[model samples]
Target: MYENTVPFKIHSDYTPTGDQPQAIEGLIEGLNAGMRGQTLLGVTGSGKTFTMANIIEKTQRPTLVIAPNKTLAAQLAAEFKAFFPENAVEFFVSYYDYYQPEAYIASTDTYIEKDCDINDEIDRMRHSATSALLERRDVIVVASVSCIYGLGDPSDYKDLMINLRQGMICSRDAVIRKLIDLQYVRNDFEITRGAFRVKGDTLDIFPPSSEELLTRVTFFGDEIEKITEVHYISGKVMWNRNYAVIFPASHYATTKEKLDRALVTIEEELEERLAELREQGKLIEAYRLEQKTRYDLEMLSETGFVKGIENYSRHLTRRKPGEPPYTLMDFMPDDYLLMIDESHVTVPQIGAMYN
Candidate 1:
């Protein structure tokens, strides 16, 4: 029966031999025995990834492969892309080419601030990974440490999505507001990802951090009458989505009302911090904090913007202290299959991240 047969066809010239067969068999046996996790202990250049892929083909379950670094993740992603030419093979890594997290050195009394430069290519890959996972049963995501970082709750992310059906009565202004609520900015001048341009009743959206098709939202006077997908590089419409639900362009997707509440909370925190500083005879720090926060509040109030906004993400999320931060993993379904490429290395890192 097809159910008992391997769902994939192996096209490689070489076949599994030596310890590879043994490793694959052991892993499969462990999985069948209700072992939720198994490690493939093999040396470098042992073709461990290949063995993992073979197991996946035999099981025919969707998989995720987590790697150690960007270089390794990229190599694994490329390999999976080649192996599963017909499947949704994706890559996820840090979107920042360089990042320095904010730190406070109380001894020297220094606040090392968070700084980062976004890598568009990596950001696009991250988007591709989540999008592919939601759309298909066969997907492989080779990722780095970025996967464990804080992100928007997937439930909220999915909830914010707006499905635009063909001939649906979607108001132009309503669609624009939805896009904004999803953290997509309206930039009539700049035509970049996560930004939309309005040409009369027509809207063109270059999805934030995506490697897929550019979505076009065209309206007929007030209603979103048609939605089409176009090639980002070629500027060609490939297909029309009977319906399209746009996800938040960024991790921070807060409504205006929410932002107002956040501002209020921030103000309260600022006052509390100021009082603490003053009590400790940190007059300089108190003044510095007051100035910085006042400037930030002004910026937030004026243009609805502030620098290094993610530093306050914990407060913005409104989660209890010590609770785990949300991440891309939350975007995955409950039954989503996961495969760690270098399980011996990856499994440990997964546990280490929580601490």
Candidate 2:
């Protein structure tokens, strides 16, 4: 675990007024006394966020603030960033602007395929949040209920991260291969996020977490020679770095070994499902399931992926049936504080999600 040396500092012009001071003091006192939960009931005009900021500054802990929706999450994130200008304030929410979930309607005999359009900018912010949590200490993430949804295992994500340093003995081809394993695409003509281009001994990579800055790694034979940051549009070298860390492009990163094992398990499940349907005298259902499962299996075998891959996530993660999927919470430090904004609505919604 990386220890954060910098303490959380609030950069605010206005001091806590009205009931804010008491609320902040009570929250801090409760936290210091090892209280499990505390509530701050305030009217709409009250400066709840400011009080929370004061408590955060006093506690000096990493924080995760959950909002009921994307709008509120974005608002909270903006406010936190303003409050703690020196700290890392990240926004995390579903990247999709619109989503149509995969569903099977037996009565209507209809199957809806999954469809979604990802917001590239939001995806970058999501990556920024995860990376900050792993690499820094003075971090605050404001997220929607999407935080409860599945994400790649943090351990696997950390394992796939590639750290490069100047003067390291490593092959250019090897580094490119590792990037490919982490789901990065190679595009020499078009430079974009999650893409890399090789120009002779130099590899320019645009990480998913960044929008404007691109990393340039120059290799000397089989050894790393230099690393620098370059502006994406201007192509100007901004600064040189001795080391850089590259995280995976996608959240659902998996190893080839895990994919192979998951394929076998998927096949076994398909067989059992087909058998059960046939025994129940539903031959049509059995045929439908068999064809669908086999098509998905073939796609998985050939391309190492399939549409709606999350359906087989249990197998990919090697989790038991009915076990909860790993979420963003798994990426947080052990002693991090969780603040649920608008808890009156957010708390019940979270309970409904589980039920």
Candidate 3:
């Protein structure tokens, strides 16, 4: 529904001054000359973000600005949102408010399982970021080092999306199935984010990327008769449209065939690993790995997902061994811009994550 193309225009009361003008011009010139990387050295309060915004507007290319941490990323995203009010300015960071990595201590013979609590709001914002990238070019995503981490395949995400247009030949039952396949819950009693409800010929869908509106589609027999945005609570129509697009409820979008293929590959990889472990005479470790892998496989077969399915992302997306995982940057076009904030610090942080 929100695939309208537009130019980025900064709605700011302040104007560029000091080195700001030179920095902006130099950056634009470098981009025009096909420079892959360019830095704008500036101290605190030097309006570097504003300068970057100007560069983005001039270049007219989608930009991803990475900060070293979530706080800084949030600040940059807010400023960018203020500047480009009409465009998509998304904040993306690790959704976990608290995270503890899984570990095993040989000395103490202790196994500390992985544990973390994800912030729902942050998760929603992350979905918003990916959705914006897929739908439009006028997007500015301010992300932390977590941006380097795997975010699933964007092609699969865009391909599996539910695109409903008025007068299309789609049955209400088919729409329900599409939502469920996209991981949307059917909450008939109350409409919540990532949920859908049906009543008679109308279907209400609350997309994960949308915060304030739900899409209401009316069906006349097997044809989509109406599509519109409605307030989530009041159910008042906000906007009428001839088209609507519903992204996956989560990033890891896979069809049944793809999942089955991934499962087989995962089993093969597990066997290979187990052979090495057995050859090394690590029998206890080998048994533990086999048991765990089988348990995960069973869960995936029944529920279509597991808690740490991302660990087997290579299998799921069918990528080569040691290949860099698909990150948020992969969602953007090859010509899209990357602006690293506080490069001296953030650059090293990115390296740490990569390592």
Error of 3 at 129 (Å): 0.8
lDDT of 3 by residue, 1-355 (tens): 3367699999999999988888888878888898988878878988888888898888888899999998899899889999999998998899998889877664555667778898888888999989888888898889999999997888888888988899999999998988877878899898878899999999999988788899999999999999999999888999999998889987886777888999999999999999999999877777778877899999878767787778878988989999988999988877889999999999999898799
Using Cα atoms with residue i matched to residue i, what is each candidate's TM-score against the true structure? 0.84, 0.93, 0.93
Q: lDDT rank, highest first?
A: 2, 3, 1
Off by over 4 Å in 1: 1-22, 100-114, 232-234, 255-261, 297-305, 343-354
Which lDDT values do the candidates have, in the order given? 0.74, 0.89, 0.88
Q: What is the C-alpha RMSD of each candidate to the true structure, in Å?
A: 4.4, 2.1, 2.2
If the candidates were sorted by their TM-score against the true structure, best first, what order would they fall in?
2, 3, 1
Number of the top-ranking candidate, with lDDT as the measure: 2
Better of 1 and 3 by lDDT: 3
Residues 1-355, model 1: lDDT tens digits? 0111223444566789999888889888988888886667778888987898898788777676678678889898887777777677788888887888866665677877778898888777777676655555666677787698887556555666666777888688888878877767888875778888788877878776456677888887666678898876677889887777566786666556656777888899899999999999988788767877788878766655567766566566676668887887776656556776666676688789867
Candidate 1, residue 330: lDDT: 76
Query: Residue 353 deviation, candidate 3, in Å?
Result: 1.4
lDDT winner between 1 and 2, please give it: 2
C-alpha positional error of residue 179 in candidate 1 after TM-score superposition, expressed in Å: 1.0
State the local distance difference test value for candidate 1. 0.74
